[model samples]
Every structure is written in structure tokens, then in C-alpha cells.
Target chain A: MAELLRTHPLEAWAAALAELPDEVRITPEPFVAMVDVRVPAAASEGLAVRGTPLPTAPNTWTPTADGRMVWLGPDEWLLTSTGTVPHLLEEELRDQLRPVGGTAVDVSAQRIGLRISGTRAREVLAKGCSIDLHPRAFPAGRSAQTTLGQAGVVLLSLGEEGFAVLVRSSFAGYLASWLLDAGLEYVPLG
Target chain B: MQLIACPWCGPREEVEFTYGGQAHVPYPDDPAALSDEQWAHYVFFRDNTKGRFAERWNHSAGCRRWFNAVRDTTSYRFQRVYRVDDPKPVTP
Candidate 1:
């Protein structure tokens, strides 16, 4: 068995999201787990780490049959998948990346993943985010890391009008409040 | 918020990036050999250009990486955005 060294990053915010407006909900995504990987784009070709290639195109993400790969920088990517053996996975990824002078390590606990989806989710996100959320510009499969509520966050389009807002655990509470406040105008009185 | 173009992430709101002060300031190759005054100059003083200036910015909210930008101080318009490794684009 591989040794583990991480705790759930979003545990503190789980209960808080449950109380968000029913019309525009902020739900803690299931802990799928994450790892940050880095490799030069030239060397990443034909190299599939955990069945996902390192994405080089800026602000884009690639989906695998089992997981997803997000391009972080010219040489950085974040790999995410569901697994209990973080140590083993990180070790294997590191070994594979070594030949190309790249590395992979765990960052699952560094961020909290939030799924903000509802009829009014887009409206709420537009309040604090500058990116044009219109379907044509940020279609599904597109991803961008930008400041939301003055906190750094990676915004990924999940589907039509639905989004995945990823933020460091420390900023989860602040972003959630911002989103809730932005959505207040739309929530029906109950 | 103003829009800042990132070489990688395209244009994002300014709040997503952190101002890294004056750019083109390199660390001394041998810090231990520098005199006290020289050290102080390197650490404390930076050109506050009134016109066009070169500076570093970290796309903290986007790519989470640092890069350089040349902008007109008076107009607050970015003249260029380039990678850290690339030569600083000439400022006019």
C-alpha cells in the first residue's frame, strides 16, 4: 500500500454550500482528487501520463475516459482522477515524467472544487467575473483561470450555463459568499 | 477593472494579476561581493518611469505564473505582453 499525506481540502466549506439558495446552488463536487504535473510541451507529445496528455494550449482542458487534464502554464498541467492511492499515483506519474525532465505531485488538498449550476448560475458568475460567459466564447470543454471576487480561481465550463469554479481552499468561503451575494437578486423569496 | 492581456490566458481583468513593481531589475550574480551601498541600491531603489515602463506581473488568478509587460504609465495602456524568457519588448 502507498503512504498517503493529504486531507480533504474542502471539508470546511462543504456544509456552507449546502445552505446556498435552492434556485442557484453551490455544491461541493465529489472529491475526484488532483495532481499537479509539469512537462515541456515538446517532450509531452505521445506521452500520456495516466492516459491524459499534458495540455499546452493556454486556458484549455482535455478530458480522458477516466479523468481530466488542465493546462496550467506553458509547462504546467493539473491531472485529476478518482483514486485512493495518491502516493502510488504520484510516484508512477513522476517516474513517467522523469525521462522528459518533468514532475508530478499531489495538490488535491490545495483546492476546493465547486459546481455552480442552475438557471441563474451564469448571471451570478457574470457579476464578479470579467470573462464573457456567453456560450459561444466559453463553450463546454473550455477552461480559464482568472480572478473571481479578487481570489484566483480556475473556471471550467461543465455544460450549457453550468460551471466548475476551482479555488484554493483558503478562498473557498470568500468566493462562495461573493457568488451567493451576486445570485441574491435572482433567488425567489420562499 | 482594467483588462490585462496574458501571453497565455488572453485578456483578464486586472484584479487577477499582481503588480510586480519595476521590471528588468536583475539580482546581483554575487550578492556577497557587493558593497552595502550597492546592495541597498539594488533592493530599495527602482525607476518610477513617468512615461513608458517595463514591469513584471503575475497572473495569480489565471496561469499563476509571472511575465513581463510594457505599458505607457501616463495612458495606462499596455504596449506589449511577453514571456519572462523572451527579451523585453522595446517600449516606445
Candidate 2:
């Protein structure tokens, strides 16, 4: 299973980091991540899980006991785990929900989750996206799907100065490479 | 810019949606019995109300769902947003 899992080039790049220059600062903030879970429409059991009908169109965000769930589309949701996400929950969701309709493809391993924080995080995002990221408009705990440098991305504002970008697994290498090149001018924090 | 409230996604930028024209325009139950002029009226004629009007809009960018809203044609302010199957008051 370890060999089957694809290696992200950025992982190697991060592993290679050593001493830093006096003027340039770099730090690592790990454990921030994302996972793609696909459940077929049938599995929803006419519940309209994402945006079909049961829940009605225009997917809504409802608070749950554990965390918040954002309906991405029909039969799809992006679940934000409050703390560490256990594999058991994923397995349970599959067992309970998968039988009603389509297969659940766990693409959690496909994408990379990067946490960009600090005073200049918004400035870094502005270089790529067009939407207003100001606190008045975006605020914390808001997530939206939009284009970032020609790449479709899910932008989530986690804090006043923190954000998470969920990029496709295949594009992770390119996005990380691009961010590194662009972030060179900033106080680089990993 | 007209402010159109999506029934599902709530109010969003007009750029994220597509105007779907007037709502509540149902097809004639018996099209075979209607005259050509009546058929034309049913197909092409639109009320084009100057005041509060019910219209359809699709959240093209966000939820990709179609819903109904009551919007003022003059000020372009959306009065109310509701699902398609929900009952709406008839303008006498």
C-alpha cells in the first residue's frame, strides 16, 4: 500500500530543507490536509445528499455535532473534521451511505492541503484570485470555489490571517512549485 | 447590476448566475385545440411587467440549480426568493 501511494514532489522538497538564510525565513506547518470523498447519487437514498432534491437544490451548510459539512454538489460533500480525522468514520460513511447508490471513491490521497498563514497570506492569494478576500466580504469560516491562476480551487479562510487551498493531486506539484517561486519574496514559512 | 437572490445559494453576484426569463408560464394543457395565435401567445408572448415580477434564475457558478424569485423590474431589487414548487401569490 505504501508503494502504491504516489509521492508528491513537494514532500521531497520539504524533506530536503536545511539551514535558512538570515534575511529569509522558512518554517513548516504540517498536518493541514484535505480529502476527496465521492459518493454516488443512489447512495443518498433519495435524500438529495448534495443538491439533488431531498435536501433540495442550492446545497446548504448545517452545523453537525462534530463539525460543519459543505455540500459541494449532488451527492458530494466536503467534510471538515474538527480535529484529527479517523479512518473509521470514512469506513462507516462508506458502509452506511455507499449501498444506496454509487461507489465512494476515496481520493483523499490525491490532493494536497497547504496552510498559508501570516500577515501577508491574503496578499499572496491576491496574486492568483480575483475575489475580494477582505474580512468584511470573506470573513473566517467561509469557503468558495473559484479559479486561482487558471486552476479550479476551493479557498477556505481559516483565520484572520490563515487560509487553506485544496488543489488537485496532479496539480499539487505545479501549484506548490508556483507558490514557492512566488512566495520567495515573502518571509517563507512552510 | 440586478441583485438576484438564488433560492438555494442565497444572494450572489449577478455574474455568477444566468437570467432565465419569466416564471409560472405553463404550457397549454391541450395544445391541439389551440389556434395558431393562441399558440404564439403561449410560446412567445411575455408579460414583461414593469413592477414586481416573478422570474427564474440559474445559479450557474455556485449551486447550478434553478429557482424562482420576485424581483422589481424598475429597481431590480429582489423581493423574495423561493423554490419552484412552493406556492406563490398570484398578481390579480
Candidate 1 residue pairs in clash (backbone atoms < 3 Å): A145-B62
Error of 1 at A187 (Å): 2.7
TM-score of 2: 0.54
Predicted structure with the largest lDDT when compared to the true one: 1
Model 2 lDDT tens row, A82-169: 3434354465555655656433334455445666666666776778776677877676666665556656566766655477776666
Best candidate, DockQ-wise?
Answer: 1
Off by over 4 Å in 2: A1-69, A73-75, A79-95, A98-114, A123-141, A146-152, A167-190, B1-3, B27-45, B89-92
For each candidate, what TM-score against the reference? Answer: 0.85, 0.54
